[model samples]
Target: MKRILSISLLLLFNLGQSRAQSEKKIAFGPYIQQMGTKDAAVCWSTLVGSMTVTDPSGKTDTIREYKQHAIYFQGLKPDTKYSYDVLNDGSNEGKGTLTTFPDKIVPFNFVVIGDTRTRNNVHKKIIEQVTKRDPRFIVNSGDLVSNGWSMKNWESFFEINHDFMKNTPYYPVLGNHEKDSPYYYNFFDLPNNERYYYFTVGDALFIVLDSEGHRTSIPAYTTEGNEDAYWEQSGIEYLKKEKEWLEQVLKLNHQAGFVFIFQHQTLYSVKKSRVEESKKVRAFWGDIFSRYGVQVFLNGHDHHYHHAYDKGVHFITSAGGGAPLYDIDAPQPETVNYKKIEHFINVEVKLDEAVLHVIDIDGNEFDTIKVKRRDVK
Candidate 1:
């Protein structure tokens, strides 16, 4: 009788522990990523080992995975809104609504914001403002956290920007600070599962590349040792494959009318930190973009705003996403404009033309320009 009582007591204790663990629940996200016409990737963090995703179409999907929950809902209608619920252990953990990419070449807007590292207050404010603008999606030029390898930093980012992330799809490029961390890769469900990839929204083909993919060694940028960190450099030395891929993709999709290429590091910036890297990219990839119909190259790593036009290609550095602001070094004569402030770029796409607006953190429009599409002839 005593043995039976002890066994029952042990079982009750184990059950109590399990219940407590379940209460801890999600760490960050029940957010959206990789928003496509027929599907959308929903990602969240929890240790429950399995979760359920319920869509507006009365479809339920059971995702069996570990901490990072990445589940895709297929057969969604283009340009349609779908409300979703993320449930864990039979309890509703998170709920948000997201819309798929437009099927037709209709007018749309996408905001570019980046370098949001270790600056929670500004990042939160930026998120609030961007949410109000209600762009179809968002593009982040990397450096989402100060320490990409640390899970805590990522948690803080999601904590501050969950509202926007849960609702809108954020296409993130690889930044130097992300350091190729597995957490970075695991958190986002992007196209190709590789660091560099592309997607189309409306008539625009958005190509995202990893500029640091060529680094032969990892920098000392993480709390953990460099051995454990996952930093790389593929943009310079080992960029042959990416270059071929870029050319192939551009050749196939140049008919899309607009090609916008983005990465964490720009090929030209007033800051000296990125001068060498920029030169290499310019020599290697600049002609490719010019040869193709690439319209704009967007990047954010200089922590300031600078733009220029060369050979029918518009180069923009919109890296002002709550990171420490940098003073403009020697300004280049080719620079169309330069600004030292926290800001984001809003790109409004029409059929024949695209408008780029640079808005500061104080809700001020500092600069705007319209780029006419290049005639393929």
Candidate 2:
């Protein structure tokens, strides 16, 4: 009986190897979730039907069966590191990680990275450093890959960011470059079938929007453009739809400590050229943010980072993902705010005010913005 069991195990291993060789390399993720307290969300892909997550408390929870490569995990502990891993079958040891989130609402820390396309080696090194901080989760501002439309480009994105996504629940906003590709909407597992969506973290309402619409005409949604700027039409319809959704979400969280809008394009360009045309976005959405008392609009474009006061809208651009920086044309547009950098933002939400740090590729702090929620009122 022992001999027979050993033979069976050997055969299974061979079959697993063979299957892996035949199957397409399943891509990973760039979005993660971190809520108030110990709550967290994670997503992964498996050749098998489903997977399980074992927490620090020794409690194992099996998530729903997945047809795709991603999903979100929540209800985790904060400010404490936890051990976790991925699984395909019973007791088969797959890769794993040591993960953690910041302690609940009183004060918390999070990292944002955008345009991590070139020198992937550098990006990996940067991510490794971020993990040491044990942030609750990560926010990818936009331009996750160099080429937005290629399957290979996206696959590379998932491969490079796998370190953060397997354990950390990631949140991604579609960038203009991302629209250059078709795989994005399908590759990511967002709340809605549409690209624009929202999620709440503690005392803040984080609204992710599409800025291309701030520049061009909206794409038609009913029928995908196919070759006819499908995204353009779809974007417009979606924004119209999202407008109603935003109204509802704001009404629900009218008193939240901070309200933020994260998107890929800036309402105002860094060079400040074509101000009249670009300003329409702020003309279109900035008022909504102001009316709703949005704290900031987190944006990316122009490959540099900067911030400024445009009326009541606070604009931020953290594009420094090593994706070939652009020589920004200054003077910007007719709208409220603009800036550029190859960096990210480390945001801390507080009772008295909210703080934002413009951080560099190595997690170095460049500048800071301290805003009082009371003043907005």
Candidate 3:
């Protein structure tokens, strides 16, 4: 009788362990990534381990770690919608839909939002609005999280965007807050080198640039006077290569009907403090946008809606995703419109033209811009 009782207890202990192991939930995502005309990837993560830390002030916090998983699909038909389940266990948590980019020129729409760093409630609301629009894809101008290194911040970001991101292919620009963290690259599956890349949906060309460049720490021996030069020179080679690549891409894709470029920092600013920095950035890019006939240049970081027109290029600052709004202190000469509000842009790519509807948080169309198709021969 004693031997039998011991056997039963051991069985119970093993069963409890099995149940505990099975209870590990997905940390975040079963999100879509690297969507193309013939291929797509589904990505997700699960908790691996965690550590507890106690601050000097006696405040304790728990930091969790996660492992990412992805599955790629190829030989897919273009302009078709497909249902995917990362987990085949009949759970809805891992189920989502994806649509491939059209093989030929066709009508489609996409949403653009920016600076979704803080203000979770506002971010959630904006995400909800974006989902309602049902864009073919989504572009986040940058600053997706307050701290890219913080797992908690990423958790919140994925949680807020899960429903929409699970279905829509998300493209993110590298913002200053990202800090060139490996987490950003790990979480996102993109095309080309991923830092600064280009994609196409039909005849519309979308180019994303890395304005933040590589985040390098200044050496302790460096003097304050040379700090700026050090920082600039650190990423000069990378930026130069990217600029050359951009010029090549633009030249090669000159037949594209529409071209939209995105970066984290603005080239034209209406804010008093950032105007000079914007000018410097503009100087760097020079006549690239106008020369390439790029229709729109979109960015984040300023936390407001600013539209500036220069040499036929529409420079739009759509950073009001969730961060605190900044006052438009000094409207530039090219400023077509500026608004301090939480908003997103829904762009409709038609046969002959692309129309951008700048909608505010309350679903009001405060601004609209229409650009005719490039004279593609």
Candidate 4:
């Protein structure tokens, strides 16, 4: 009897060990995505395993492998809240809430943040403040991670944003720091061609443009003098195609009550170093924004807050999410206001106009811009 009892205990120990090994732990997300009037998606990742490698210098690196999972829902009610559990195994880790976008014209509010790369503490604080506002959704005008190719960086990003993103849908623009990684595409479920797309909330149109065309390496044989030319020509075709698409989208949505455009690069930079580049960008998309009545053109790249007005379009650089701040040394002719501080914008869309309250990390409102709704025929 004693021997049998000992054997039973050993078997139970092994069973418990197996169960523990088999249990799944969420590594990222279980966050809301692809939010629309009647459909939504919840995505999550789980650590599957890890591998260690030793370099020539005897430096060891351990890479964690993760498996991504998503559940999509359809035929849901518009502008309604719903709770979801991806795991449904009595674990809160897999649980989250989501609200669908409204199907009809109505008032709403959303948040815009940019360059939330590095400075996890600051990012967390910004998120805390943004959460208090209870925005319907959030848009990051690129640079979501310092190095989009680094899984570790992404891990930190998702961890910091877990609580807020679990309910609010996130839309991201592509920044240079993203390095055109496949990881960015893997994590996001965007509209249209993904790179450049447009979405609508009632009569308000939100367009995201991919200013950083396809990232490619220069040819080894290219001479130093021709390097810049090669770089320019590499993505010229893609940019042209994207421009055509943008024009078509703008033309089709000309009657939108509110039109907001977002990109990763600025068209009006107050940073001395980036002024020329900004001019080049502005020249490339000459007068298109004014012609299409884009009320606000929001971008990130320069780590500061600068607003400019030209021909009915408001150009804003709100890249104050964490990354080191840069000085506003070159104020352009159209500059309205400039500040070198970390901040985010809360846009409240009402019947007559949309009010943008530019609030800093300390919860101080520094500037406000109101764009009247476009009059429809």
Candidate 5:
């Protein structure tokens, strides 16, 4: 009887494990982190059809199904409250809440960080800090890799903090690590033709550029494997297209309040492995932003923080995401021309002002800067 009972218990335990796996949901995020998205933005991994939007009064609004197309939620009101859920069939996957912003100049807030590869738990901790401050959205300056863009790292990244991602609409810039696989293309539904794309939030038109592709497309680097030919062997061809796209976006949103360009790799850096961005590439984009009045450029590559400016554009380099650190690459000898901080930046855009505050993983204020785009009444 003892032998029979022991065998039965072992069988029951195995069955329980099996059931857990079948129902095993990796719950990541369920918070409202994005603003200025009228109704649609890329859904990436979120199940659009399964999402349910609810009001504060508990009135639920069902999301219409999206069949195979990239997920973009529509029919939402401006600067309004809505609770949501990313469901799997009739079952639930995760939940979140969000507020939409108006088309014209509206006040908003956002956070910025980058190169969060190999530091999965760090991302989680950072999210915890960010929630306390209650900003609008988050920007990951890309390089979310663990060794050359492996699928494992990508999966590990989401596994570690799907909760934060689900809750917040992360505006990710393309980094060297994202090249690990075609998973970014498959997993993330971004704007524009390629991963290097653009979107507008409030008064800002966010452009995500690809530094790896830009650098690697040089004749010295891309004499082979020209298979990914969106442009010629020269990455310059691609940047030109991006420049043209920017011109169009600018012309289209001529009355836009601000333009912030984000990508991996800093315009200036102290990391030995990476060189200062080729002036040619910088000049092309820099001139356009200057010509069009983009106020800032945000980037990450040398897993550290450095902020500098050329002409009028503020370039913020924030690449420390609980990963190992790097030394500063100051451009000037007398003046460093860069503010270094190993923390995330919170940008608050009110009806009257836009404030940039840098905070540590513990939510400590490291630095602050406020830019006035227009006159306040």
Candidate 6:
């Protein structure tokens, strides 16, 4: 009897272990990306061999291949709330909430922050503050991870960003620190091959560019696989295509109430390493923006907060997303405000105007700027 009982207990224990192992989920997101007026994309990684997404109205979408799933929730109404879930083998795995973009110009709020390369504890704090605001979505200017090639870095980011990333749609630009890693590209479902793209939310047009692609030729920043050869192979082509695309996009959408461009490098930062690159990129793209009447250009890389306005354009360096802070060396006349601290920018867009607020990690607003939407006719 003792021998039989011991054998039965061993079998039961093994069965439980197998069940637990089967329950473990795959790493990373089920976050919102590529949000639109009537549809949105949800992406996640699962090794159970397939992914299934179920919406509030009981509509289900499924994908049968790949370890990662990019499921689109289509036929949704404009500016409506949606509750969604991800299931693996028909078992609930993850849940998130989202709101579709409004079809017309209306009052909306969005948060912009970046340079979250390290210091994950502080990054979590900033995310906590961001969650409190409950903005419609969040835009990251870049440097999301210290080493984008490292899976550990991405795991760390996803672990800490669970609160916000899981629920709020994230639109991120590519930072130099990202190194154009496959991990970076695989993590988000972006338009235009995830290099650079533009999207309109309400009446505001947000343009994301590949600054590192365009500015790789500037001075001492060349690497063996990342320099002229890289440019000749692909960077140059990408830059040219993006420039032409930008001109056309701006021309067609010139009547947009607001045009905001975001990237990884700053056009007017006092930081030492970025000086030459900044000048080069400014020369390359500044006139294009001015000609198109781009209202604001947002970026990260300075690891601080800065605001500058030049020739009818606003230049904002908001790299305060948990990276080590850098100070201003020499403030320019166009610099309206500067701060060395962890912070994020909140922009509230209205039909004819917009409001920008610079808020620190402690949840204090230090500055506010009001921009009137330009008449494009």
Pairs that clash in candidate 4: none
Off by over 4 Å in 3: 1-24
Candidates 3 and 5 compared: the better one by lDDT is 3
lDDT of 2 at 112: 71
lDDT for each of the candidates? 0.79, 0.60, 0.89, 0.88, 0.61, 0.80
lDDT of 3 by residue, 261-318 (tens): 9999999999899998888889989999999899999999999999999899999999
Using TM-score as the yardstick, the better of models 2 and 3 is: 3
For model 6, the superposed segments whose C-alpha errors exceed 4 Å read 1-21, 47-66, 88-92, 214-234
Number of the predicted model whose lDDT against the real structure is largest: 3
- Candidate 4, residue 363: Cα displacement in angstroms equals 1.1
Q: Which digits, one per residue and each the tens of the lDDT, describe model 4 over residues 196-255?
A: 998899879999999999858988999999997888788989999999999999899888
Candidate 1's displacement at residue 369, Å, is: 1.5
Ranking by TM-score: 3, 4, 6, 1, 5, 2
lDDT by residue (1-377, candidate 1, tens digit) is 00111000000111122666756566677888878988888888765355677999999976544367677788877878877766533344566778888889998999999899967899888888787789999999989999887666887888898888888988888898998888888888889846899999888889998777756464556556554334323234457778888899998885777889998878787887667657766776758887886889999888889998887888899888899999987666668899898888888999899999889887789999897765553
What lDDT tens digits, residue by residue, belong to model 6 across residues 191-298?
765888899988899999887774344346666666645554556566778889889989989889899999888898777666766787787775898888899999
lDDT of 5 by residue, 272-296 (tens): 4454343434655667766777777
TM-score of each: 0.83, 0.72, 0.93, 0.93, 0.75, 0.84
TM-score of 2: 0.72
The C-alpha local distance difference test score for the whole of candidate 4 amounts to 0.88
